[model samples]
Target: MTRITAVWTARDDLAAMLAALNVDGDQCRYVGGAVRDALLGIEAADIDIATRLHPEEVMARLETAGLRTVPTGLAHGTVTAVLPNGPVEITTLRRDVATDGRHAEVAFTDDWREDAARRDFTINALFADPATLEVTDYFGGLADLDARLVRFIGDAGARILEDHLRILRYFRFHARFGGAADADALAACTTHADRLKALSRERIARELLLLLGSADPLAAAQLMADCGIWRVILPETAPDGLAQLEILLAREGQTGALPEALLRLAALLPTDPLLADTVAARLRLSKTQRLALGRYATPWPTSGTARQIAAEVQPADSVAPWLLLRAPDAMVSEGLKSLEGWQAPQFPLGGRDILALGVHAGPAVAKVLGEIRQRWIAEDFPEADRVRQIASEVAQSAG
Candidate 1:
């Protein structure tokens, strides 16, 4: 327990904002993720404050202090105070009065314990006074934090009822924090698996992409499968793809070097382009991402009939080479290295040169230019007469 004061903190501006709110340091605490992450010596992404002030009072003091404020969800008694470090989400202490298995009807209160009890997990419920740096542990979140456990704050079923997103969040947090299901958490997640359907496809897409991008995503994914949550959200992804994903993940850690989530997802799903496209559209992936995924699903098949058929059904040659040559497995780095000693060729012929050869200004001129360019790349652009010969042959064939 490091006893520290606000003035000695890195969040000096945040401290100043709370002070301007005329908030009693004794009543408000720097709570949730910031405190838990700090204890683990990891950088916190967001700051949340649990305050004794009513939402209206908090907003008033913020305005008086010259800080811009937004009542992000005043009905739920939460306010957003944008500070220099980041947006600080301040919420009045509250407890749930009723839940519809998707959202909760809450009543504001002044009890930190009651507020903590309403959170999703114990590790997430830890609170600390950043000024004094004193932690308040009502549910032994510090212990769970040290153990990398993802324990629910109270009844998992009740928590799931309040917000069904917790079912996916449970697995995501476990992948990040490293934990196993308590019997209750696992059971409730299975029971409420169908509730995930009510979540917007965009929301589910975001969470699933994050999960697939994690270092040990397979662990959480396996847990989801075991709990029957996989079938509800993404039943189209083949089990074979999951197995391939595991192998790919083992070779690649979640660092700056890992492949994109869409690519990995492509490796996991069906090889059929139509099925892949359908899945990508269903997840609402961006157009570019969906196109890239389609490429992954139907890789460069070297010998199959599909390969021959696709080759016979040709696209424009110039663009096709550019796309196919840059496939994900392309040894681009090595190829670039090999090109270090190589130099490119300047075309010996131009449209004027072709026109001099009696080529008309119609499609033949463009066709002649393209033939010369391909010969340049293929023959490393030898002498002028050699390219001219190839171009002349191509023009004769076209005529």
Candidate 2:
């Protein structure tokens, strides 16, 4: 048994919580993703535990040990114990009584094997004793972990039928963990591709973004497209810009910057404003994300002139130039790259400045100020003296 020596085990708060909950190390054990990630030498975010004790018993024992307990999901036999380090979730062992492709009705059990069998994947079913550091694998999760295989715990089709979201999860896990899709798992996902439509739009969108943000999502994304999964969720779009995505990712890597999710998402979309709006509304994207999508869809100026590029650029929409630079035209791409150092210069003159120049505070004054600003931009943002001269000329003519 490979012992996990992650920093989580050495935390004093965790040791206190474990000592408080364990009554000889047979009743409670750390389980699920935390165990799996620890074994793989990855930093686990959330620590979860499974125990034979009932929810009420777990609460009583923790409170007696002077630990704060929250009934996060009592109906599901789960309780959260708050410690100084962080909150650790403790759930009673459970076996599925019934499932409806989306939710499961579970019965609390004391059998560890039953709990392990009820999980989705073999890698996620392993358990570790917090006190003894003993990892118990009912399934062959250790071997699967060693091989970097993301196989379903039991029958792939049966597990997926229990919850169709697992189809997306199958690809998501592959993208993050570095593995080829399990043959049976991929086949199950392909057969159930249409079932993804039955899922809530928010759920589908969330899963899709996470999958896209993974370390290497190209293969998983292509697989999703090939299996018709993309058609069900994003029927209007396809993985057509994968080559552009590869280029963008490589460039981002060279700069040592994290890849932006929205940029990657844009690679999958068609440059049509109406279609972008529809997709944004369908996914219920936030206002900022919608605006970025809008910028991507709006056509950019084809002229490679500095004035033309400056006219199209806005401070809030700076990412637009980067997205447009990926265009097939070499001249257009070069023009955008040249404007990398260009900042939206503050207009030296304002409406008030025009009004003070003997111009009345009305639409005429506003028009003069606008004209002066345009002149400044057209001249590649000349010095303050040139801007003042232009503003004065416009103000005098309007007055």
How would you encode candidate 1's per-residue C-alpha lDDT over 227-344 as one tens digit per residue? 9987888888787867767755643542123445665666567666788889889989888767766665664544322222222333312112212222343432333333344334
Which tens-of-lDDT digit does each residue in 1-399 have in candidate 2? 677768898889887777777765588888989999998888998999999999999899889889999999998999999999889999999999998887889999999999999888888899988877789998899888888888998899999988888989888888887476688988899999888877888887788888888877888877877787878888877456666566656655644446566667766777676887888889888877777776666655554454445554653444434444244444444554655665566667767778778887778887887888877877888889998898888877775
For TM-score, the strongest prediction is 2
lDDT, candidate 1, residue 393?
A: 76
Worst 10 residues of 1 by lDDT: 316-325
Model 2 stretches astray by more than 4 angstroms: 299-346, 378-383, 396-399
lDDT measured at residue 32 in model 1 versus the true structure, 0 to 100? 79
Query: TM-scores, in order shown?
Result: 0.79, 0.87
